[model samples]
Target: MTLTFAAPTPDAIPLHVIDQSNCDAWLAGQGEQVSQWANRNGFTGAAGQTVLIPGSEGSVVMALAGFGTADTRARKRFVLAAAAAALPKGTYKITSGLTGRALEIECFGWLMTGHTFDRYRTQSPSTALLVAPAGIDAKRVEVQANAEALIRDLINTPAQDMGPDALQQATEALATEFGATCKTVLGDDLLSENFPMIHAVGRAAEKAPRLIELNWGTSGPKLTLVGKGVCFDTGGLDLKPAAGMLLMKKDMGGSANVLGLARMIMALNLPLQLRVLIPAVENSVAGNAFRPGDILTSRKGLSVEVNNTDAEGRLVLADALTLADEGNPDLIISMATLTGAARVAVGPDLAPFYTDEETHAAALFKAATEVADPVWRLPFHTPYEAMIEPAYADLDNAPSGGFAGSITAALFLRRFVTQTPYMHFDIYGWQPVAASARPKGGVGQGPRALLEALPDMLDL
Candidate 1:
């Protein structure tokens, strides 16, 4: 997490970036001394290749990285991270042209590459600190890194230690750090407090479902966030097959993401009243578990017919959204690892968000571009509303037809949100595989993009 930028000097170790087309020219410009040394040392700029240049004093003087092609600048952002992975353990600073957000992102990339889910065991090759650039905000980089780390830690923990109560504790801890007010309506209290849908979905689990809330900031605009916290979705009575249940530990990704976003907002001290609502529950099967045909009443007073127990994310979100809407917030954004349909539609890396407000959508899209945390917008097609209709309830939790699964899920949640300019993000919080900058584990999606976009959205 430590980043530093220093002035390049001959005495300083060099980091040479090389592509196939530029490698020879770059070496030739260094003149006979360095070029002969490079040639003798068998250095060639092949992708993923690295070589250390020895100086006359037998000291490591320069490190060469291979890019292999001219059009690799798009991938150049990961160069520092790649170097971090390959270099000997120590501190290093950039000696070349890396500035602005690109520098921050490269620093972030290196930090992320160093993340390890070692909750149950030891991790080797600990992260090496990189000296950040001068004049850059070290606190800001720490804020983002800490937030993302919180998400990964929460999501990486096994369900045994990360159940409903544990998740609530995590939020409470966050609230304490930011001087925010924290509260939880637990167990039967959810029903007494009018969170019937949340109670219904969580009643079957031994952990007992509840709503966790945290409020921060003095005031500017009222912005509320709701996240689905299905701790471990066994798919309830409709029971998911073994394969579907394997990664169920990450079902609470929505809640994890919300907390992650909340951390960023509070850390940056964004000028707004921020309220975060997370409905924490373990959607497990039991004799008392709400049946598939059961009609559950939401806090919004809308009746929801349970068509599929596996679609419980929206059910819990409904009550949380209603509670958020009651506060009459200017904006409400909800994130959830809600559907496989979302993955089918947009894949894992890119989350799909639904917002009726065009201006807000544009702001988020612009932010995504600026931050490189991309998200795509899916329409709130009014015509698709019919798919969620039920014979005996205000709406069905899951639509019968399979078309636009992600869209129908959004449409279902929209019924509960009446006034606020709301946006629903269906995010796959788990990275199925690792990349140069992104490791394989829990990821905090959209929050960085949202944070980057917020000042513009609020015209601050």
Candidate 2:
């Protein structure tokens, strides 16, 4: 999957957009030669209609795509993606007057439509080439697209193959690619290393649990990413209903997204030391599985009482965040499919991020708006910290009363991240329904906005 953006040649075919009301006016303004060819071919630009005008040199002169009434028209950003997918492999420019965010987002759609996760498949499309708009960076688009694709692919894979060990392998592979240092503490080693909570949550699974670490770059600001890699969350001893367990394979979507963001950082060669910590585990139910009423100690030495084994994502993330905080990174960002409260607040398309740092939140908001990735800011609410307090332990993994579950979860993670500027994103990484650019499957949330905002956040 390599894409190239080069300057378009004079003979490059134009992608013309035609609205229903302005079709005649647009065709009237065309060159006499092009107009005659269009007329002879009966090219009337009706909404969702397409026509190719042939040139005298046996090449396509232009492609006309129709739009419906302006008021009634579908507001799909990637309406032209299907068209792009059908185009021959060549550098192309949208001559449809798209600019600013519209142009950037549409180009992103074009690039994404060209993505095919054929890692174990027999057939895949050749990368589609498109000439980037003037002042737009092709490398940036490629980085974002690659990151999103990686996140989607990882989340879409089943638990059978994408368990903790496989996650370590993926981390090691990325480390090798970027010349980063990689290490892991597996199974009982997690207990020896003081990641008892992580080990306890995953000890019952056949595929052993591990904490994966990757370090890259040097001599700059430090940025750490912590992800909850609950490889297959079956709700442990508490147990989820059959419906709730259906999408448990994607419970590690946060880990996938963090790895995706890490890929972008390494690919762009950002001027910052990067560390990724993933507490990869499978929350399975067995005789040995950690249960409710159990008290576990985390890497930070904080005691956590498990009230509901279903709330396991935060347990793994707590350990990873504690390890990341040990390095005292300038900023720490953690992503997890940690709560249903987030989805109830902002739905699946919008991820909600919690940060005490206003400047970082502003940067993320701006980047999300610019990229159309869409994230809303949720409050840390220091007062809510009391909600997670336990009578017998330092904290309760599951807060009582269930009010502000997402905020309380953020507060729990905040306790583990002391020195660094910390932010937590509670994301629903699966799109329940299909839309313009987002298909109805594993979706990458927050990584795009995070990747776009990082260079500026780190002052690179």
Candidate 2 residue lDDT tens string, 1-460: 6434546777556777666677777888987877777678666654446567777887877777654455633344465565565556665666874677757776777777766656667544534456777656778877788788888788888898899998899889989988999999998998888888889999999999999999999878999999889999889988899999999989999999999999988999988999999999999988999989999988898999999999999988888898888888899999999999888888887899999888888999999988878899999999888899989999998987868999999999999988889989999999787654556678888887987788778887
Q: State the C-alpha lDDT per candidate.
A: 0.83, 0.83
Model 1, 227-261: lDDT tens digits are 88888999999999999988889999999988998
TM-score of each: 0.93, 0.90
Model 2: lDDT equals: 0.83
After superposing candidate 1, which stretches have Cα over 4 Å from the reference?
Answer: 1-14, 18-21, 37-47, 67-79
